[model samples]
Target: MSNTKDIPFSPPWQISDLGKPDEPKVTELAAGPAVARFAKMPIVIAEDDLVSRTLMNSLMEKWGFKAVVTKDGHEAMAALRAEQGPALTILDWMMPEMDGLQVCRRIRESGKMVYVIMLTSLGAKENIVEGLHAGADDYLIKPFDKNELLARIQVGLRILELHAALSARVKELEKAVGQIDDLKLRIPL
Candidate 1:
């Protein structure tokens, strides 16, 4: 039997597995998303509930994404600051010390463009709008399905790719404009 233990970390659904004797473990950093496949963009997971956190991390690996897992908003913020690359984030709506909304707002103010997805059990329309206004790109309800979450992540990946392309194009245009200006300066009036 797979030995996963329950922990009494606040918010109830917390779990921790000691180890499965015959299984190989997945680490916090994986090559799937951060290597040749997902453009080296790490996905940040900030969930308070241990069970949910563990499940999300597992799914991320299976979905071919590298993850930086954080216990709460504070840790998530630290991870965001330290990641130093384009990254997508999954934030839990309710967490101790700092909630997801607070984290989302701070991320928006940082001026770094990252796709944020709010993971919550709250399915109300107003709640979703609140999350969006806080700067979340999308929202996923709890007990999420494997395939659906993967598809949603795929959408985020696509958007991130598009953003990167646009940024590159802008740089090229700026360089060309600079060259043109230099040539104009050399022309006789």
Candidate 2:
């Protein structure tokens, strides 16, 4: 992990070095367009109520994200572990299998940096504090206007972007430190 060189540009077996010398550079041509045409990343939306889930899904899709709708917190957790998971989750506070608070706790315990927004009917100060304590990045009370919901989500996305940038910077610093160590090792005593 200290070495960025160990991180491959493409995984083994993804491309072959055994190709003909004059193969027209097919791999680069194919990959260039594929990466350019990448689809919108998905967002997972968990709401037990049918109407609420549908509304959330429609809103998320309208915002140019692929939305996965689930009626239970447990199901949403499973989706989170799936390959190519959503970068963010919008959770309703009340749900079967497990409640939103429990789900948020589980997500935090897993130590993955997935953005979470808890949409609940409970608007009291204590309730908001509890949600924040349970690891919700944003808390939205029920009967919230669509504009507010979008605005909060926009804020969450910005926060997530910031987190990603910070992570990258940390990785870069670690790599630089490793290089310095390597250079020191090569120096005479």
Q: Highest lDDT: which candidate? A: 1
Candidate 1 pairs with clashing backbones: none
Q: Give the alpha carbon lDDT tens digit for every residue of 46-122 in model 2.
A: 89999998888877655544577889998889887773422578888878779999999999999877889999998
- Model 2 RMSD to the real structure? 9.5
Weakest ten-residue segment in model 1 by summed lDDT = 7-16
What residue runs in model 2 are displaced by over 4 Å at the alpha carbon? 1-39, 83-86
| Candidate 2 clash pair list | none
- CA lDDT of every candidate: 0.75, 0.70
Candidate 1's TM-score: 0.79
lDDT of 1 by residue, 45-127 (tens): 99999998899888777654568899999999998888764678999999998999999999999988788999899889999
- lDDT at 127, model 2: 93
lDDT of model 2 at position 136: 94
Query: Candidate 2's C-alpha lDDT?
Result: 0.70
